[model samples]
Target: MSFFSVKGLSKHFGGLVANNSIDLDVEKGEIRGVIGPNGAGKTTFFNVVSGFYTPTSGTVEFKGKVISGLHSSKIAKLGAVRTFQRAALFPEFTVLENVIIARHLNADTSLLNAIFRHNTKAEAGNLARSKEIIEFLGLKDEQDNLALNLSHGHQRVLGVAMALATEPELLMLDEPVAGMNSSEKAVMVGLIKKIRDTWGITVLLVEHDMKTVMSLCDKITVLDFGEKLAEGLPEEIINNDKVIEAYLGADDIVA
Candidate 1:
């Protein structure tokens, strides 16, 4: 089995079918990008696979375990975590604090451990790991700053840092570089590459920026009108006529 995959997955909101039997297979340590036009069901697919939404049919498998309909927290505990289009963090918390809090997934919550303070070692380890994540994401300089005090780009990076703190085997990102300037996008692009190469983490992202998607992904999947439109290497996808016509107008083909 691949590291992460969704087979015949579909999601429906009332009578509206957001995702219609979409199938995606992502190998371990690969950076996969999902792109589509507005209402292509890209976000719905991400939500269903990440456990934010339940599939109307089919299944989501991670590490060969069927995880469809699992709670989001349980799914995260199983080593798959995802980020949202907007930065998700505690606004009043310092960057370090926010990340440290996210490490709770790995923390000991047993009553005995808590009452006896036997989790001291665990807490210390979480702190060190959180700091490592902060530095790895280049948020070390702003570790002491409140999350809301950081710039938009930094906030987005902080969200990534929080996700990394979970030590996931599969990291799902939704529009990771959304609302960023060119330099910020470049930084995020490099950071994502390092996240995969250095950490050996598998990445599955849905993004709108064709350039970022082309540059970062090992494979690209295209969706249109709630169904799979195309799937191939970045080069293949860019040149695919169906993809060009569906995702971007033929006249405005992606370079």
Candidate 2:
């Protein structure tokens, strides 16, 4: 079995079909990008596969088990975790505190114990891992700062760090570098590569930046109007007529 795969996945909203029989796969330690024009069901696919929404039909498999009907938390506990398009953080908390809260998901302590601040080894472990993840994402300098005080780029990376705090085998990122400027985007690109190379974490992302997708992904999947239009290497996807028409209407998705 593949590390992660969606077979004949479809999502329906009343009379409208957002995704229709989309089949996709991501291998271990590979960076896979999913791209298409707006309203092409990219968001729907992500939600279904990540268990934010149960699919109307078909299955989502992760690490050789069927995870289609599981809740988002359950899926996350099983090591497939996702981040939102926006940086979802506790703005009142410090950077380290935010990640430590996320790390509590894997803690063996009860909510009461966590809330009252137990001095157990488990709590210490969570703090240690949270610090590790914060440093891994290059947010060590911002560790003591309030989440709301960080720049947009740092906030986005914080979101990713929270996801990594779950110790996910497959990290599903939604537009990881969406609103950043060139330099920030470059830093994010390098970090993403490092995440895969150093941690062996497979990444599956939905992004609008064609340049980033082409450069960062090992393979690309194109979705058009709720169906698979094309799937191949970044070079092939850039040159495909179908992908070109879907994004630019006249030029390539990479153009």
Local distance difference test values of all predictions, in order: 0.88, 0.88
Q: Can you write out model 2's per-residue Cα lDDT over 63-128, one digit (the tens) per residue?
A: 899999999999999999999988899999999988887877654555455567787777777778
Q: Tell me the RMSD of model 2 versus the true structure.
A: 1.8
TM-score of decoy 2: 0.95
| Candidate 1: count of backbone clashes, pairs at least 3 residues apart or interchain | 0
Clash tally for model 2: 0
Candidate 2 lDDT at 150 equals 98
**Candidate 1 off by > 4 Å:** 109-119, 250-255
For each candidate in turn, give its C-alpha RMSD to the true structure in angstroms.
2.9, 1.8
| Tens digit of per-residue lDDT, candidate 1, span 105-141 | 5444433443343667766676788888999888889
